[model samples]
Target chain A: MVPTSYYIILSAALFAIGVLGVLIRRNALVVFMSVELMLNAANLVLVAFARERLSIDGQVLVFFVITVAAAEVAVGLALLVAIFRTKHTTDVDEVSTLRG
Target chain B: MESLQIPPVDLRLLTPLLIVVGWASALLLIDVFFVPNGRKKITGYLAMAGLAVAGLAGIPLWNVSGSTFSGMLVLDRYSLALTWIFLIAGALSIAVALDYLPRHEIEQGEYYPLIMFAVGGMILMAQSADLITLFLGIELLSITLYILTGFAYPRVASEEAGIKYLVLGAFAAGFFVYGIALIFGATGTTSLAGIADYLSRQPFAPQDETLFLVGASLVLIGFGFKIALVPFHMWTPDVYEGSPTPVAAFMSVGTKGAALAALLRVTLAMEAARDFWLPLLAVLAAATMIIGNLGALGQSNLKRMLAYSSIGHAGYILLGIMVAAERGAEAFLFYMLAYTLTNLGAFGVLIALEQRGEAAWSIDDFAGLYQRRPMLAVAMALFMFSLAGVPPTAGFMGKFFVFTAAYAGGLGWLVLIGVITSAIAAYYYLRVVVKMFMQEPVRDVRPELTRGLNTEILIAGVATLILGLLPTPIVLLVEQSLVALGG
Candidate 1:
């Protein structure tokens, strides 16, 4: 059987990559995808931990995360479209009508 | 295999929450089918009615205290008090929006229902006793707010603010989920009480302790963004400046108060690890107060200034939460109520002055307010005074209580920083007052005052002064409502 430590390590790497993507990407869509990736990484952690403990609660929480991620994507994409219609771009830097 | 036995469901415990979510759902359908395009105010009124009904439902359950859904949700006076605060904030927001939406040509029947759902989410956050429920509650609140922020669909800035909030909020949510997973990995349970039980039986493997501490920090980071602490508050000014006035008003008080309420519970549940978090949070609180106040000093836009001010206010509220185990909860509740009324009234005045155009919300717009509209000027001055911690106003009393509580909890430095930042904050707040009362009208701007807007400002302004002068009754009420955290 695979060790939970290895799973945690892989998920941690994936989470870090997601955070990096969010920070480095200028396109709003890619940044949003990075957020989804981070959430999935967390889901990976949950499943691995649940399996290690033989507990169903952690696994159940994964479903909730997925459902929420979907809802988030729905809203995120809608907002992107709305911004695109007005600003004609999804580049986060371009959407800077509000600033100090 | 034996039949699976479900945990005993306590429907009565969830009466208020159910009423809010249920009414919001039904109202969504009703708005779509029955409401006409131009008559969206009916939906707003109906939404207020639902919130009122839900508030009334909580009155009967004031003395009731227990958990339902297998200990996922709690019903206690603490939750009940927070519920009424959220409801009042929601209703006031709806009232402020009643005329502003149509006036700005962004009136949508869906607006009111979304606000109710947001309130429901806040209530859920306050009632949650488990990490999973807290995650759901936060998401629910975030999603609704994202939509509300973008509700001004034709406005480019609104769309931008909405997307920015979504990205940042989702980023925070990701951290929250990862934190919960780590905690569960370490303790084998997600329940607050279960976590406390796990921690109480200490002497854990060092690996587990590291995981628990990391997880706790991650959770705090997630909440830090929600409550607009210093480093995490980048989105606040832009978001508030872009969103509709009423929605911004709601987010300022509603989101901050709810998130802090939940944070208090989380911190209390982890009381066994006080040495680990106490200093960390204290430093964050100090930075939040200092930086937030300094940030507000430079903003000329009323909404942006208020946003920064809200961040500073969150710092003050954090002082109460840091000492919540001792006497901070009472202070926390009082500060929330005072901040709610005071901030909402300030924003309500902003909504009154707003006109249909992109270049609105300049500080100069407040010039000659006294000469043009004496009543509006006076109300704005009152709110400014209250927010600046002037005596005989709610904000002053709130600051006093929180400072005293922090002092008692041996956090003297935090209280001092709070006072100093407040002194700095008074400059900007008083700038508005001075402009309103003294300056000549820079732009001959005619405020579009409606009955609903007037009522919002009146309710909030009067309540702020009343709570400031006679805080005894509410203080007693808050003290009694501090139920024992089963965790």
Candidate 2:
């Protein structure tokens, strides 16, 4: 059986990579995918903890997270579409009309 | 197989929340089926009526308190008081949107229902006793706001604002979920009461300490982004400037107030770890006040200025939460109400000055307003003074209460920082007043004072003054509304 520490370390690394992606990535779509990656990392942690503790609450929370993430994606993609319609680009750099 | 058993649910405890969500859901259908194009103002009026009904529903539950849904949600005076405030803010947003939407040619019936849904999310946040519910509430509010932020169709800036807000908001949610997961791992539970129980138990396992503290800090970061603290406030000015003015007004007050309410509960639940979080929050409060005020100084746009000012006010309210377990809840509630009225009123004036083709939001737009429109100038001047925490205004009373509370809570240094930064903040807020009263008009611009906008400004203005002058009644009510965790 895998140790809980191993899962925690793996999840933490995934989360760190996700954060770096969000920071370094210029494309809105990629940045959003990175957010999904971060959320999945959290889900992995939750499932690991649930298995370690022999409880179902953490696993249940994973379902909620996944559901909410779906809703987020729907809105996020729609927003992207809205922006794309006007600018014809999803590059974060090009959407600088609001800068001071 | 054994038969499944459900926990006895208490429907009565959710009367106010149910009214809001149910009414909003119904309004969506009613809007599509009945309300026609160019008559979306009917939908706005209906939304206001729903909020009024919800507020009335809460009055009967004022003295009642309990947890329902197997302790997922609790209805206490804390949630009740916040319910009234959220409802009022919702109604006022709808009121302002009624005219502004038609004028901007963005009159969509969906806007009113969406605001109601957002209000429902806020009430849920305040009533949540478990992390799961809180997470849902935050997402509900965020998702609704993302749509509303981009409601201004075909405007590239508005859509850009929507995407920016979504990206940043989702980033924060990532942090929030990870924090909750770590917290659950540390304590094997997601319920606030359960976590408190674990924390207060004997021997206090040292292995869990690091996990819990890290998790708590991450959660604070999530909220920091939402409330626009210094390091996490990057999206605020752009988003406020890009979104529609009425939506900006609603987000400025509604989101911050709801997040603060939830934060109060979270901090109070973890009171066993006060030594860990108290100083951390104090430093944050101090930084937020200084940087938020400083940020506002250079802003030329009215929305951006109020965005920064709202951040500063969040900092002051944070001081109240720091000492809430002992003596800060009343101050927090009062400050929330006071700031709500004043900030909304300030934005209402901006809405009045806003034009169709060109958003007359520059500070210079207010120049010589007293000569052209005395009543509008007076209202704007009053709002500015209130925001600057001047004498005999709600903002002043709010600052006084929070500073006194912080001082009593042994946070004298934070109180001192608040005072100095407030003095600095006064310059910017008063800058608007100076422009309105003294300087000559930069351009010949006419402010549209529609009936809806006029009524909103009047209600907010009159309430701000009354609360400032005679604070005793509301103060007593807020004192009585102290959060009782034992519900």
Candidate 3:
């Protein structure tokens, strides 16, 4: 079995990549995908912790987190679709008529 | 594996949440199937009724102290008081919405129910005794708000706000969940009691300390974004400016209040880590106050200005949370109550004047408002003064308690920063007041607002003044509620 510390480190690395993706991405779709990657990274860490502890709580939390992530994706995609209808683009930079 | 026993459910403890969420979903279905599009106010009224009943249900549970859902949910004076606050905020938001939605041609049936669902999430946040429940509560609230932010379908700005909120809100959730993972790794349990037990033991191993501190910092980052703290408030002005005024108003008060309630609990449960987190939070509180007030100075749009003002208020509220050991929870609760009334009233005035599709919300739009709508102008003045923490308004008393509490806790520097920033806040808050009372009207045409809005303005004005003048009883009530926090 892979060591849990290795799994935690890998999960943290994935989470950092997700964070960078969200920060750098211009397209709303890509930013949203980055958010999903982050959630999945958390899920990975949660599952590895569950395996190491031999407890069900971490796994149960991961299940709820995934369900929530799916709901979030649904909302995000709906918002993107609506935004696309009017703006003709999915770029965050283009949607700045409200800047202060 | 041994057979598992079901956690005995507690219905009485969850009466408020069940009534609000269940009726909200029911109202959504009813609106879709039976109510005509033009008559969606029925659904809105039903949502208000559900909230009223939920508020009443909480009255009986006041002072009740226990944990349910196998220690996942807490029932106490603290949660009960916050339930009343959230319910009132929900109902007032619907009042502001009932007219604004239809007038703006965005009277979707989902708006009221979504607000209910958001309130339901806030109640959950207040009641959560475990980290999982807290994350769920936060996400549920954020997801509904993301949808609600874009409820105006054809408006490009509304859509922009929606996507912005969704992306940042989701990003925040990732931080929250991973923080939970790290805390679980360090503490070996997610329950607050377990964390308290572990932290209470002296001399933690280096690895556990790193995990615990890093985990706690990440969790605070997540909450900081939600509450619009200085370092993480990038989305606030744009989102509040673009979203419909009433939705912005509701989120301004409800989200900050709920997030702070949970933060107070987490701070208490991890009290042994005070040496690690207290100074960090105190600096955060100071920076938030300075930046929020300064940001408000440059905003000309009414909604955006209020958004900045709310950020400033978040800093003041953080002052209360910083002194959670010394009656600060009580101060925090009172400050939230006063803020909800005062801020809602201020936003109500903006909602009254914001013409459909025209964005009639500049500070100049409020010029000569006194000549046309004397009472509305006066109400706006009241909210502004209260927000400025002028004596004899709820905002004044709220600031007094929180600052005094901080001083009592020996956080003199934070209190000083709070006081100085509040003076800076007054200049901007009073700018609106000066416009309403002294300046000439930029235009003669004014939009018609509902009589219900008048009631809302009145409730807010009367409550702000009354609470300001006589804060003793409410302060006592808040003190009673924070008993569990050792206040």
Candidate number with greatest DockQ: 2
TM-score, chain B, model 3, is: 0.98
- Which tens-of-lDDT digit does each residue in B426-474 have in candidate 3? 9998998899899999876495668778888889989999999988888
| Model 1 regions lying over 4 Å from their true place | A88-96, B1-4
Query: Each candidate's lDDT (Cα)?
Result: 0.93, 0.90, 0.90
lDDT by residue for model 1 over B273-374, one digit each (tens)? 999999989999999999999999998999999999999999999999999966788999999999999999999989989988644599999999999889
**Residue by residue across B310-398, what tens digits does model 2's lDDT show?**
98998999999998855688888999999999888889999988988888899999999888888989988888888889979898899
DockQ of each: 0.70, 0.72, 0.65
Clashing pairs in 2: none
Candidate 3 C-alpha error for residue B177, in Å? 0.6
**Candidate closest to the true structure, highest lDDT:** 1
> Could you tell me which 10 consecutive residues in candidate 3 chain A have the lowest summed lDDT?
A89-98
The value of fnat for model 1 is: 0.83
Which clashing pairs does model 1 show?
none
Model 3: runs farther than 4 Å from truth? A88-96, B1-4
* Clash pairs (backbone) in predicted model 3: none
Clashes of 1: 0
